[model samples]
Target: GITLSGGQRQRLAIARALAVDPRILILDDATASVDATTEARIRLGLREAMKGRTTLIIAHRLSTIALADEIVVLDDGRIAARGTHDDLLETSVVYRDIYEHGLLERQFADAVEARGGRQPLEAAS
Candidate 1:
């Protein structure tokens, strides 16, 4: 029996493809089911492995998409917007939605950090 999580299957597929040593790799909607941490690690590994090859990554996760040199957004099978991360974030609704969600998560984390270490309130003496 073969069992694999969606992300694992995707990564395995990628590894298998890489083993063939192709000049170009295309990943469509990869990393869709992996946890954030695991996804990040996989993305990092892909980045390293794609050093000189042309890689096409398709993902709904903004963090993954943001790493691309150029981002092409499609709507109804048409190119709605195309540019770098910052450019698309500024001009594309789809990109902006994803990027803003990521930003909000970061802001929440920063806010938690800014609160400093928490401590139990002292009882009346």
Candidate 2:
């Protein structure tokens, strides 16, 4: 039996999805299991792979959907705002909260890494 870690499973799932060549791609926190560095690399690949296709990415990590054509902020299961990243930052409190928290988390993780300490939450293996 083979046991795959969360990150491995995520990568495998992404690969399978890409292999299908679908017209519309829906990715729900596709890079959540990976670390920041790995997520950046995967984002680059995703950018290329997503070209010429409509991609709907549901991610709490702002970086994951930073380049989206349009962003929709949802609060309490309802759409609170809709716009680009910069736009939402100005008009959407929910989006700002999410962005600010993610920024703080990244900064904290970087500080820990710099001090030769592990992140509070380990990236999925």
Candidate that scores best on lDDT: 2
lDDT over C-alpha atoms for residue 114 of model 1: 65
| Clash pairs detected, candidate 1 | none
lDDT of 2: 0.91
Error of model 2, residue 114, in angstroms: 1.2
Quote the positional error of residue 87 for candidate 1 in Å.
Answer: 1.1
TM-score of each: 0.74, 0.91
For residues 1-125, could you state the per-residue lDDT of candidate 1 as single tens digits?
98888878877887898899889988877788776778889888888888899989877777887878899988778988999998997889977877788888767656656656322233435
- Give each prediction's root-mean-square deviation over alpha carbons: 5.8, 4.7
How far residue 19's Cα lies from its native spot in candidate 2, in Å, is 0.6
* Candidate 2 residue pairs that clash: none
Count residue pairs with overlapping backbones in model 1: 0
The TM-score obtained by model 2 is 0.91
Off by over 4 Å in 2: 118-125
